[model samples]
Target: MKEQPNLRDATYQEEAAIDSNSTSIAGLVRQLTREVPSLFTKELALAKAEITEALNTTKAATIGMASGGIVLLGGFIMLLLSAVLGLSNVVAPWLAALIVGGVVCVVGMIMVSAGKKKLDPAAFKPERTINSMQKDKEAVKGKVA
Candidate 1:
């Protein structure tokens, strides 16, 4: 009863029996050179796009935070000015409270306006480039699954 040859094992053994002298590292590298550029280009583009998106997000967040801080500081300054005006009788007996109060009010209004401009939601809305990048990312993720 002769044993049947294992075709898978025989094929592997036949491949291993090839002349080792026929292959070289440079030939392997040459083969890879033909395949790698397209893959690398795809990966590089994805990375660049991801980085650009992250930077834009950071810029938006920073603007939002700075705006919030400015608004809060302006409110605090307004409160302090009110307190000073109320205590005018003791702090500066001769100073005209109305003049100082009016000036402070003007400054507060300016701060409020500046803060509002900074925090304007429309200003930070994603541009067309960012929107397209987001769509591309979503498409890639969809394909991955």
Candidate 2:
């Protein structure tokens, strides 16, 4: 399958030829002013696209973790039961079972929480677009200076 082009990494390439249209510095400024926002809009769209793709991937992983955690709990229940039975000799049966179940539930919840953290939108900040925009800003400032 062919890979889709990443618009965020695109650069404008132009020949150093004079335009037949208005060549005044004001004209250039006008064009830049018009194009800058368009470029930024495109960049932002690209960032959103990238984040969406990452979200799909992270979603799968998060789902896997959550499901695994659930399955682990099912299996852990059996193990805890055995543990409770063994501990019953030392402690009360009900107390032992409660303690074991509580500990296992906490561990399972922690795994689910870790998965939730991975799915956080904040975690998917568009690094490439941010860096590109920063460079663009610096270059524009340098030109103005």
Candidate 3:
């Protein structure tokens, strides 16, 4: 007669097979679903904060774009108005053109000045970063020495 397999060993092998076979893709997904809600909540919160920050900054970006557009549109309209008025013949066309040109130039200069004022070089952090790097290099050299 053929020798029979040991009951305990056979049971252990069956249990291992069950363990391996039970962990299917669906089972893994269910496990992840059970554990991921907290992680999802944290990520969702982070995303919301980032979105809020972007939303807050959007107004400033929009205002900047609108202001630039308005400046361009205003210059265009002024030029058109000047041309129309000059053609209507109350003043000499050349004189009107000169006056309009001067006005436009003045407005452009004012806008440029305003833009320069708004652009603060001090706000950039490059100098601070350079200083920190210089300090770090000195420290590293001292350590090597």
Candidate 4:
């Protein structure tokens, strides 16, 4: 009885048949032209998806920062008023306001710094899309050569 070819050998034979069918340079060029546009469209879709995801992430961060700013402003106003009242009898009221304002200013600065970090351009880079594009570029080059 004849033995069946192993999967690997069968795959190789199939690939060989395909390669032989397209052995001509014109065939290769036709294949490239047909495939490259499809590949480009897929890459563009991936890039668009990644950018949309990044933009969504940025939107969330922006909302957080905006919320933090509003809260910080309200907190600063309330705290300053309370601190001024509480310290008015202990120290000059102006000095108390100045001290409270400085502390609140520091807290706002911290919030701003955190927000700035989140908005970093590097963090928004479409890493997977970039890597995929590089691989596709190499693949195209190999096919051309």
Candidate 5:
């Protein structure tokens, strides 16, 4: 009769592979445990650096953009003067200028407020890195377990 294979006993390659896996997992777990904190610190530092750079850029751009806005506002005010003059045939000139200038300024401020909202620093939180760290934490837990 032919000899039957032993189901309970692992062969040489199987044992080797299992040992290799366990050793690698242990090594990876140790490396992760040691490096994750430092990695997070570095990432945070990078984010702060990038945000600071961005803030500086924003400041410079704001100056240029504000100048452009002023120039545009001057042009618009000139055009609105024509409209105000036309309206002055019916209403008083000062009333026309006040009504048109006030409405234009309010609309411009609203647009600026919308732009300001987009540039808010709080919106640039390190969400991606935080999520990656959380995922890595879960993966390390799975490996250790």
Candidate 6:
């Protein structure tokens, strides 16, 4: 994909050109007043686009995982049935089913626990957008100071 140019970079270049070309402080201030609002609107649009992209990615991945799980579930059920049948040859049928069921339940609990740990809110955080906003915050502070 072709990369989009950064709005901030373009804005900075425009500001630089304006600073050098303009002879009056009033003209510079007037230009800044007009640009700041547009800059903010562009930044918000960029952040919204980033967030939407992240959500779309997560949605696609979830759908794919759910589809794969449905297929795997059918195979898993057959495998479990085979295990129970094989064990039944060595033990009572009831005992074999109980044994397999218990093991499967325990394994499932462990997997759920691990999955819960991995499901931290941070996993879905918009790190790039947050970092960009932080940089912008610091730049604004520097300008103010």
- The per-residue C-alpha lDDT of model 5 at residue 125 equals 65
Top model number, TM-score: 4
What's model 3's lDDT at 27? 49
Report the C-alpha lDDT of model 5 over 1-145, residue by residue, as the tens digit: 9988786565776566555665686666665666789877976876677677777877898899899999998998789989899988889999988888888889889998999788876755656667766886787688677
User: In model 6, which regions exceed 4 Å deviation?
Assistant: 1-32
- Runs of candidate 1 exceeding 4 Å displacement: 1-23, 86-89, 93-145
Q: Compared with the true structure, what per-residue lDDT tens digits does model 6 show for residues 60-119?
A: 987998999999999999999999999999999999999999999999999889978865
lDDT of 1 by residue, 1-145 (tens): 9999999999787556443422765544554455457655765676677667867886888899889989988997787677667768566733646556677789879978996786555643446546665775675455333
Model 3 vs. true fold: TM: 0.36
Clashing pairs in 1: none
Question: Worst 10-residue stretch by lDDT in candidate 1?
Answer: 17-26
* Cand. 4 Cα-lDDT: 0.84
State model 1's lDDT. 0.66
Worst 10 residues of 2 by lDDT: 12-21
Find the 10 residues in a row with the least total lDDT in model 5: 13-22
Off by over 4 Å in 4: 1-21, 68-76
Estimate candidate 3's alpha-carbon lDDT, on a 0 to 1 scale.
0.66
Query: Which digits, one per residue and each the tens of the lDDT, describe model 3 over residues 10-57?
Result: 989867865674567654455445545765575556556655665666
Note each model's CA RMSD in angstroms: 12.3, 9.3, 16.0, 6.4, 10.5, 8.8
